[model samples]
Target: MTHTITGSAKLLARVRRIKGQAAALEGSLGEGTECMAVLQQIAAIRGAVNGLMLEVLEGHIREHLGPDASAAQRAEDTEAVVAALRSYLK
Candidate 1:
């Protein structure tokens, strides 16, 4: 939680940027913008979301699965994380 608290401002900024991107996408659609333009905005949103996921996952690994963790435990945690990420991205 301390990691989150300390990084709240940065995280919120990223979220706000994502929100702005979403709003832009909505506006583009409403205005009948080009399909490629809307698609580009969607791609940008996906990249932003992925970046946020990476940050959060890194924090989880550092905090929940510390450096001292056993190799087997680390492998298990890594597998679970990868599976969850695949499900989410899909």
Candidate 2:
């Protein structure tokens, strides 16, 4: 979304942090870290990713599906969001 572009710096920072988390997980595996710590790292990565998704998705809904949109437009946007969610969940 255009708003996301305007706010790209913040989103990019989150992505970078998530990438770092994944890299740390890889390093832990390479170094034979214990299973519990590895699992915790994986969970941290998942939470970061989920948080990023929520921010983007909320922005999209607010910008595209707001009250000013026509009924048909809202319906279409809602469908598109549902499809995206379905794919993401899979």
Candidate 3:
């Protein structure tokens, strides 16, 4: 819980890389790239986004929901995670 990505250089780097990939995907689409090429770019962006989400989520779980967590804290964390998953699914 005390640990956060606010000062994490590596996590910040991941965000920047994801931003670059998204830009590349948009550029490819705007350039009228072929279907397969554009699809590849889209796939790359999706994978990058998923990777970022997983890194953050895993950290949250390990830090905030570990054995030291109280029952209320575990419930809160579980609800938050479920909400995030529902949103992502939609």
Assess every candidate by TM-score: 0.79, 0.95, 0.88
Model 1 agreement with the true structure over 22-50: per-residue lDDT tens digits: 99999999999999999999999999999
Model 2: residue 54 alpha-carbon error in angstroms: 0.2
Weakest 10 consecutive residues of candidate 2 by summed lDDT = 1-10
Q: Give the TM-score of candidate 3.
A: 0.88
Please give, for residues 3-89, the per-residue lDDT of candidate 2 as tens digits: 699879999999999999999999999999999999999999999999999999998899889987889999999999999999988
Looking at candidate 3, the ten consecutive residues that score lowest on lDDT are 1-10
TM-score of 2: 0.95
- CA displacement after TM-score superposition, residue 46 of candidate 1 (Å): 0.5
CA shift at 26, candidate 2, in angstroms? Answer: 0.7
Where does candidate 2 stray beyond 4 Å? none
- Worst lDDT run of 10 residues, candidate 1, spans 56-65
Q: Give the Cα error of residue 78 in candidate 1, in Å.
A: 5.5
What are the lDDT figures for the candidates, one per model? 0.87, 0.95, 0.84
Per-candidate total of colliding backbone pairs: 0, 0, 0
Which portions of model 1 miss their true places by more than 4 Å?
68-83
